[model samples]
Target: MYYKGVYHLFYQYNPKGAVWGNIVWGHSVSKDLINWKELQPALYPSKPFDKYGCWSGSATIVPGQGPVILYTGVVDKRSNEVQCIAIPANTSDPFLTKWVKPNRLNPIVTADHNMNGSVFRDPTTAWLGKDRLWRILVGSKHDDTGLAYLYRSKDFVKWTRAKHPIHSAKTTGMWECPDFYPVPLQGKNGLDASMIGDSVKHVLKNSLDMTRYEYYTVGTYIQNKDKYIPDNTSEDGWGGLRYDYGNFYASKSFFDPSKNRRIIWGWANESDTKEDDVKKGWAGIQADVEVTFSFSSLDKAEAFDPNWVNAEDLCAQKGSKVQGGLGPFGLLTLASKKLEEYTPVFFRVFKASNKHVILMCSDAKRLLSNN
Candidate 1:
């Protein structure tokens, strides 16, 4: 979340080790988003609400009250999750280095009688509606259906759960780091979380815990009804449009008011084993890559096979080496001078009956050496 004149980042961190236990919100600030300076752990297991662990959450800049964080906290050994809030100890400070959780509303929202506490986590950035209520989503699951439970607040303190989920789909399993925001239909600029109208379209993204991939749907948000309807243009279940077909997960996006665009951050799980990570003294890193592709035409594109329902399976069958009408085109990274060994990150386009099906593959299978 960008605050004042600096960009603040709060992430799940293990202060004791490199491999994912003893979690807390590690804070860092940057003037340009490129270079960062680390701060003390922002939120940790001090109060009973987050005694077990301080997990994933998002930051919202309240209208009058500076920035406040809404994150999931594990309350007990059962791994029960609850939504909690934290405020800057000193909002006047430019960096907003210190933070405190108020006892009055530490655990602001929790699982009700109908929901399972263990599955509820990752509250999204709160957005205000035209009716003057702040809305937020908490990720969860019911049996095989992934859910984004909706909660509305008037003062950003007290909140109430809606009768039904804002959005959900079956067979997706647990949805983590759920994000909801609006994007302008005609321009490249991004809209604030609260922005809604005929000129803009809404987006709902979720990280599937079962598949370890994330999918997003561009659609309409019925604010008055507290519901979201995904467009018929794409699938909403397991076979859906993914942000990345690779290891990206738990992504969060925020509108960059300074730049009039949105920036997304995600975790790419390490390819190495935990034992290897411990030996290296690091487990994860954040990355950003931008690429432009040019194609002559789709006239020669290969016909897409309807039987290729699973993207991962399709990529496995027709890899980068396999040529096609429109693709098997992209860059080769970490390559040797001889071209005998390299990792190919590319895309393949298959001509479906009505629309084109694109497959993005970052194949490390052909990588000959780690060096």
Candidate 2:
């Protein structure tokens, strides 16, 4: 009944022959949020508003309506303000054929009065508390304070402005599309921000929270600004927006009403990641995760050492109780993934963190290769 089902993904892609990238949104179809099939583009950038690119954005299912889209329509560098574009989901072939044009209500947002009008873009949409109102987290001010500009809307189309910007150092430095919503405690990382993110620890009872992964991208927004500080912050108290480690960005999440989940994924490609561009082969890859979140007693759950099991040793931990998990846990490296199914492939940090391993069991895969 949901056409493409509960979720669909659209990312910035540069097809066969275009400028290095001309802003065509490559799409993928998914029903279970697990397996995904790469489909042709769903949207293309040609019009005056988004002539340069149809950058990152969010998709909202409109119940009796349709998929009300809210995305950044990035124009040329001369005036690169991201415009808002909306579209209905059931409009195209979706396999590699025609693309859908946005509706008449284009440019729901243009430049912001608060930040540098030019850098203010990448709209992350979500419910603004219980007001039934909506909010867009626009990353702005690359010229000086780089911050996530907060703009609220009563109807998805109309807009309002927040009293303050997320001026915290954590939220500054060229903050791109920011996805925000309250989530429950994930696991335990002491009092650190990881406390909530560490929530994937207990029984695999699915909740509307990160049973596994979710994150945002960041750089120094603007030499840090006092205005960006949260209201609750005291001079000494620790408070500021936190980066999702490194190596993630331009991310936005959709609030799924049907499933009661706020699922998200990032481009996984950043200007900073330019180093790995050559080594990884693919210019960009989607974050290998589907996330849900909660906001209750998050620490009550027992955490699992997701990275504890090496990809090759997945079978070994089949029945083993998990110790504190680590990523790329023990030989779960890319080298081990060449053959067949990799087990216990619960979480991948992508970059080598504490948890990265690829210990092989049979060596049969390697034995033949060595021959």
Which candidate tops TM-score? 1
TM-score of each: 0.90, 0.57
Question: Which ranges of candidate 2 are over 4 A from the true structure?
Answer: 1-4, 17-20, 89-103, 112-114, 166-171, 185-246, 255-262, 269-281, 286-329, 336-371
| lDDT (tens digit, per residue) of candidate 2 on 121-153 | 666544333445555566665443445666766
Residue 249 alpha-carbon offset, candidate 1, angstroms: 0.5
Worst 10 residues of 2 by lDDT: 202-211
lDDT of 1: 0.90
* Residue lDDT tens for model 1, 1-371: 88777999888889888898999999999999889999999989999999998999999999889999999999999999999999999988998888999999879998998899999999999999999999999999999999999999999989999999999998889999999999898979987899998998899999899988889999999989999999887789778888878778899998888988898888887788889988888888887678988777878878988877667778888887778787788888869898779888889888899998888888876855553
Point out where model 1 deviates above 4 Å.
291-318, 324-327, 334-341, 348-359, 367-371
